[model samples]
Target: MSDRSPAQHSDMLLFLTDEQLRQGIEAMFFAYQGFTADPDRILAGMAYGRAHHRAVHFINRAPGTTVNNLLGILGVTKQSLNRVLRTLIEDGLVESKVGRVDKRERHLFLTEAGAELERKLSDAQRARMRAAYRDAGPEAVTGFRAVLEAMMDPNMRRKSSALKESST
Candidate 1:
């Protein structure tokens, strides 16, 4: 019997066939669809796309977050995000105001209606996540989280970890 760390075990199993990789790719595609299914339905009735949903969600999560901060979080180009933000603001869902200390910076917040919509969208996703987590069980849930955290880019992991720490 050989004793190897979990990382070493994963490294040793790195040789995968084309079929295996194809299966993984298919699984990821399906998983993404499943993840988006509920939100897609909700957005369909509202005439808003995933970009609006994402902006509302992050604004709800961190009210008064700066535009630059959101641009960083979403990893989207400034022009792209500006279009979404403009639409959301015009639709009365998001409120963007010049920063008190720094007039050039825009801080974002969700209105009452915006918060309601955000809650509805989040509830749908949470229901899906809850069911998947329950089906996967306690051990798999832990390992799944670990693997996802490990998969994150170094800077992203730092930001994610910081958010987790702050929320707790």
Candidate 2:
């Protein structure tokens, strides 16, 4: 809530020095580490990895999403995602159903155990984000989100927007 207008803020970004950009990059790296720390510990105990956590999260978000759709969202090689999916399927954490319309398509869903794990992961992340948002105040929170959205490429931004729209 300063006296500056949106144009002033945009102009200010134009003058960011190399050191400023470097510092911002480092901050993002450290912030990501902090954000993932809790989930990493949880995954370690379960003999899982971040890839599995990501799959569980996205599947929970859009139950019955197709494997091809997931591959697009995750941008992982089919072989890699298949390995993770295989493990999850074998562990009884995820369920895959053959598509009725297209027999070749496989839809993914989280089982009860997967849902529980997703809850734990989400709760941990939400707690951290809640505390940070509280400390940063509403304006900073909004600005931070805008900055993040701006950083994404157009394709990713569209995908992100679609997911957000679906949630609402």
Candidate 3:
């Protein structure tokens, strides 16, 4: 693939053998496991799992996010998200307020305890990502992000980019 023209690169990608694609898919599976390993360990002790971690992370990112918006972001069923939210709320990690203007809407915010948990989870992930990016190098990091973005659904990509921009 080295020194290939962009057209050639496209052609090569289009013609990737089943074996090549399989290897890439396998790599992604393993990489995801590695990425989640630390957080999984932390969540295990709390009787929570990846779903809870994901909810906390996103809620921390966008305080006062509505339940409906979180449902969209997480792509989980209303019932399932409700279960997680109920647990978090009961544990005092999340506070859900009735929307002032919309009585049916529940806007979520992390309590101090929730923020602390989010910090720990994020710190672990950031350390892992930072080391991996350093090992992969700047160019690989750029290419890696491009590949990830390209793999996302267009709608999800837009949502993700908007969050990134807002965060910065």
Candidate 4:
């Protein structure tokens, strides 16, 4: 707790200039575009967009999540989510069933085809991430993840942490 002097800490804070911050912002934009490129191509073939990918990803991550839970996680309007859900269900990629204990609640699950698609999409992204992480090295990867977590809203951060915990 008493390692660094005040002057040293101030010097480090001053190192992050406005221009440096802007560069970091631009880097993030390009990185995100590159990250999504492969999945975009695959989704384009199926006429689906990033929304569909997100829904599939989250549903695969949480097999028995409810629509209300998804809505909270996704931060999308009911109408918007309904449109995406409808298409996925119609395509047989997602199956929604009434909750056994709560008749009014709809629980979402990925069908076999849906799981296959999720695997394909995730595999592409994971490969890109693996390569990026390898190139960045472990220290940079840890910093990158910490920065990402810090950028998330408090509620989203909690949700992300919960999901990470559950997956493990």
Candidate 5:
């Protein structure tokens, strides 16, 4: 149990006013912008955007993931994802293969060049996250992650949790 008294807990909850909520929302917006700044700069030179970065990041996280599974994870339309996939494939950043057990399914993996680009993008983001985590301390980082998970939609939360589980 927490050490705080009932009155103290109640008072803390009451402190979350409209203005406080707005400030929190604004903070999240700015934080997201900062989080993507480095990657955005790198992608801009290559004529890509956040969508491309997200696809590469996820494909790297789960190598040999199917296109259908990726569509679910990304929550994007098939046409939109197809466009990105086409570009990545044409650039030799990603390779697509037919599933042995399910010939109809297409499994995606990063090519050597794709892995290098993924490393560059992730390194930038990781450095920012590492610094932020260090500055926030362990407890704040934990709380921040909890807040983010709570903010996700139920389907997205499940997908994210599955990815986390798979990585471990």
Candidate 6:
């Protein structure tokens, strides 16, 4: 198998059974449910959904990030994001300011309330992940990250890589 030619890649599908594929699909579903469980509970009390959570998280990660920058990071339609932004802004959770260099552009920042909420939401997930990582050990965590990166679609992969670069 290790010595297979380039043409062998096309025929690789023949080796995978339908049952194996179904099992993989089921694993992803259950894993995602577990991943969202903690944050979902926190959001339930606040009348917010995953969209709001993501916006808060990103704004917290990059203070004074432009609306366009966030749109690219989130891959969401502008109207949809505008709705979320409106709610957050009205609720005093987030602030939008005119860009210093480009006055037409809106820059996003989380207010004290937004920061507190984001911390609460992230802390819940971090506690779960910290325990899981501790149990899985360092190598397993590395492999998990590698698998997730490999599974990303091309557009998402590009965005992910960009975010990783910006963080450094």
- Note the Cα lDDT for every prediction shown: 0.85, 0.89, 0.88, 0.90, 0.89, 0.86
Per-prediction TM-score: 0.84, 0.89, 0.87, 0.89, 0.88, 0.83
- Arrange candidates, best lDDT first: 4, 5, 2, 3, 6, 1
lDDT winner = 4
RMSD of 1: 3.9
Q: Name model 3 segments beyond 4 Å from true.
A: 1-15, 163-168
lDDT of 2 at 82: 98
Clashing pairs in 6: none
Estimate, for each residue in 70-163, the C-alpha lDDT of model 5 and write its tens digit. Answer: 8888999999999999999999999999888788888889999999999999999999999999999999998999889989998898888776
Tens-place lDDT digits, model 2, residues 1-168: 555766645435477899999999999999999999989988998879999999999999988888888888899999999999999999999999988878888888999999999999999989999999999999999899999998988888887877531111
Q: For model 3, how does the per-residue alpha-carbon lDDT over 1-168 read when each residue is reduced to its tens digit?
A: 555565535545467899999999999999999999999998989878899999999999988888888888889999999999999999999999988877777789999999999999999999999999999999999999999998999989987876531111
Across residues 1-168, which tens digit of lDDT does each residue of candidate 6 receive?
A: 555667735546566689988997898899789888999998998879999999999899888888777888888999999999999999999999887777877878999999999999999989989988999999999988887887888778876665531221
Q: How many backbone clashes does candidate 5 have?
A: 0
Compared with the true structure, the alpha-carbon lDDT of candidate 6 equals 0.86
Model 2 TM-score, 2 decimals: 0.89
Error of 1 at 159 (Å): 2.4
Report the CA-based lDDT of candidate 4 relative to the real structure.
Answer: 0.90
lDDT score of residue 96 within candidate 6? 91
Candidate 4 lDDT over residue span 1-168, tens digit each:
555767534435456889999999999999999999999999998879999999999999988788888888999999999999999999999999888877878888999999999999999999999999999999999899989998999989999977531111
